[model samples]
Target: MNLTSSIRSAFTPQGALRASINLGNPILACRDADGAARGVSVDLATRFAALLGVELELVVVDAAGKSVDVVVSEQADIGFFAIDPLRGEHIAFTAAYVLIEGCYLVRDDSSLRANEEVDAAAHRVVVGKGSAYDLYLTRTLQQARIVRSPTSPTVVDTFIEQGADVAAGVRQQLEADAHRIGGLRLLGERFMVIGQAMGTPKSRGEDAAAFLAQFIEEMKASGFVDEALARHGIEGASVAPAA
Candidate 1:
């Protein structure tokens, strides 16, 4: 069957992406003031569904914790999240689409620099609880005392407001942070490069993995991904076929 047909038969009358997935999301999917799912996640999910000629059923998580319980519990077929190898053991990822660096976020008046110096015991670092950065900090910076916030915005805000020595998130997010939280500056070069990929249920079956891989490849070849990021004012981004 064609891709369209695959989508049609992929679920029952409920139109699930997979058998166990129950659609919902606060940011990605939501019952608007009138109860409707909307946001950047919605747009991406919609586009992917249209690309495959399928109906998208969103699955909402607590928007806290791992924030991917929908996919992890087999309640959803895929999820969009930052790519990390630590997560790779549990889930399959699409190709590296967007690049993010875990950088230090500090107050403009602060004497610290982003990624300028090694993390030491005296420097307190704040990151979202259960975030990829949290895992990185726990594993890499054994000496630094790590503090956890419940969300990305909170960490950025707290860091700017003098809640911690630094905060961590993508550079693109930092651009937004400068406007929303003020008095904050992104510090240092990237600590590590993280890619934005789709989370598919991990499996020995290459079908899902292969689809994600090809989706990323075609997006790069067509320039659609680049155009999308550029339109959003995100710069210095590129996509090239693997050598």
Candidate 2:
């Protein structure tokens, strides 16, 4: 064991190296001045790569249906998004990093301030078609009428433009332009906080899951997750270190 460890230590660089695959979210991902993608996925992935002694290459793709297709086809190594068990056949997921709460945005002047006030027929809820948010509404709020769009940002815009009464969106975009959401108000509390896990091609290997587990553990110890959140201007998160 010691000999094997010595060999690995000698072969590995003091810094991280490159993996067989690396990925980036084409649609939701934002880039910094250095042109590196920057978001929860970006930050976390970078840290994960660092932990594993590998360099993360942000694989860019066209902005359309499930950018994860690149990862699924083995064009990339990892996919940082909400995990779906149905897709488990093509990709293996790491332990979930955080709870993804699907939120609803409404006009502050509207009557949907609370979850109790959600009305299926009265309010038109804009959502991304075939998205996790859509699935949630379809399963949980069977009564709600949702206008399916292609993305969360567009859904929020639908409500802002008076095309819909409500919009389903992630926490970041909802809070990013908080004031410019066109007088919109966050309706109700979180509808659901689905655990989000990262995915890597099943054929690639098990290192994806191994590295993610260790990455999350390190982030928890170093408070990197909280710092990442604040760096993006996000607030009201329940992410204090767990004792």
Candidate 3:
């Protein structure tokens, strides 16, 4: 895991690697009982720091927009994010390490029985502001009106409070909310599959990006990524297809 001087210099300019860990995506990150961040993304950042032979300084945030903003502003060296065309303008993504589902939730009696039924003009959908689901639906949903909540974890509450026709978010989070509150059912199938990846500011030279891409691919092939998911008891996410 020895890093060349150039790659190290480009990525870890401040000596220690500052990683922006977003806890918004429960499938990727979460806070444990000790209030410490622990999840797939946290594991990846830890391993990444080991590979780079540096100290890991975690810049934790509760929302994805904050994570992206930190990386783009160089407040942190890198962050875990969903690969989206819009984000690529400022960040370079490594090949995805995991695939997470994005699904819709509706009241038990709602007419939206299928994923495709959600895009009708009359239906309003609520999503987390700047989340992968929010960005994807915004681009692809030509008819449905999108109501953005302040954050991903609050989407369910926002949907219930605002009386939005549909709620969109990580399948696991939606399922948890449904179980806690009752009377909500997930749609038949997921509307999107998000590619969870590590991203560095595009301003960091391509050598750093290439190095990270290779590191992720190797981690997948070597079973390290799978081990992390299992260690964290994560489910409904799988190793992404090879780059």
Candidate 4:
């Protein structure tokens, strides 16, 4: 895609493409041994900056909500996030480049054997504050009470600490936590499928949004996203279909 002046200005008014990198989602991004951001999202942001012919300034944060805030407040040129209607009000999202499953976890002794058993008045569910699953469950789970953890990576810890009945988050994350912490098991089925996408502030205008959407489609078609996932050793997530 040609980097038109208007698209350039929309994406980099500050003379650099400030990409918000959320380390909270391990599948998308994480801190390396040296604490530098690295993962599929970081790779995508780097390539997008190269496409725009601008310097890339990563505005790294520890949580998904902070990433969304940086983009919606125009502090960053673009960010990666799960597609949600609430977030869409302030940010114009591109078509999803990856799809991830949202699953629930419980102590091994817990009676909740299936995903359908999670919603009950007696159940207190723990979730990453302002995460995709949090937003999703808040609207869908009619009876269960939600307890918010500081971030997605902390969901399992928070769940155990608070003695909550259920923990919710990305499947890969929950699985790793279950293996690390032990004595925890995931429900038989996923509760939701999160569509992870790139987004810019809505005020950036349609041209910028259109360009991002096109960029995602091209990346998916060219196998950039799939390659990034494989390069990062990401599991349990798939490249989204062309939009």
Output the number of the TM-score-best candidate: 4
Candidate 3 on 1-243: residue-level lDDT in tens? 447888888888899999999999888889999999998888889988988889999999988988999999999999999999999999999999999999999999997788888889999999999999888999999999999999999999999999999999999999999999999999989989999999999899888898889989998999989999999888888999889
- The number of clashing residue pairs in model 2 is 4
Tens-digit per-residue lDDT, 1-243, candidate 2: 022333323223333322222222222356668965566667776765554455666665322225456667765666665656556778777666656566777767776668756756666777766566776676667566778776655666656665677787676567654566457677658877756556666765554445445556567567777677668655444342332
Q: Write the per-residue lDDT of candidate 4 for residues 66-153, one digit (tens) a residue.
A: 8999988899999999999999999999999999999999999999999888999999999999999889999999999999999999
- For all candidates, what are the clash counts? 13, 4, 0, 0
lDDT of 3 at 23: 91
**Model 2, stretches more than 4 Å misplaced?**
1-29, 33-35, 61-65, 116-119, 205-208, 238-243
- TM-score for each prediction? 0.76, 0.72, 0.98, 0.99
Model 1, span 55-155: residue lDDT tens = 77766543334456656666677776666667777778777765656667777877776464547777888887766677777888867788877765567
The local distance difference test score of each candidate is 0.60, 0.58, 0.92, 0.94
Give candidate 4 misplaced runs (Cα > 4 Å): none
Best by lDDT: 4
**What stretches of model 1 exceed 4 Å from their correct place?**
1-14, 18-43, 60-65, 114-118, 160-162, 235-243
Off by over 4 Å in 3: none
Model 2, residue 193: C-alpha shift (Å):
1.3
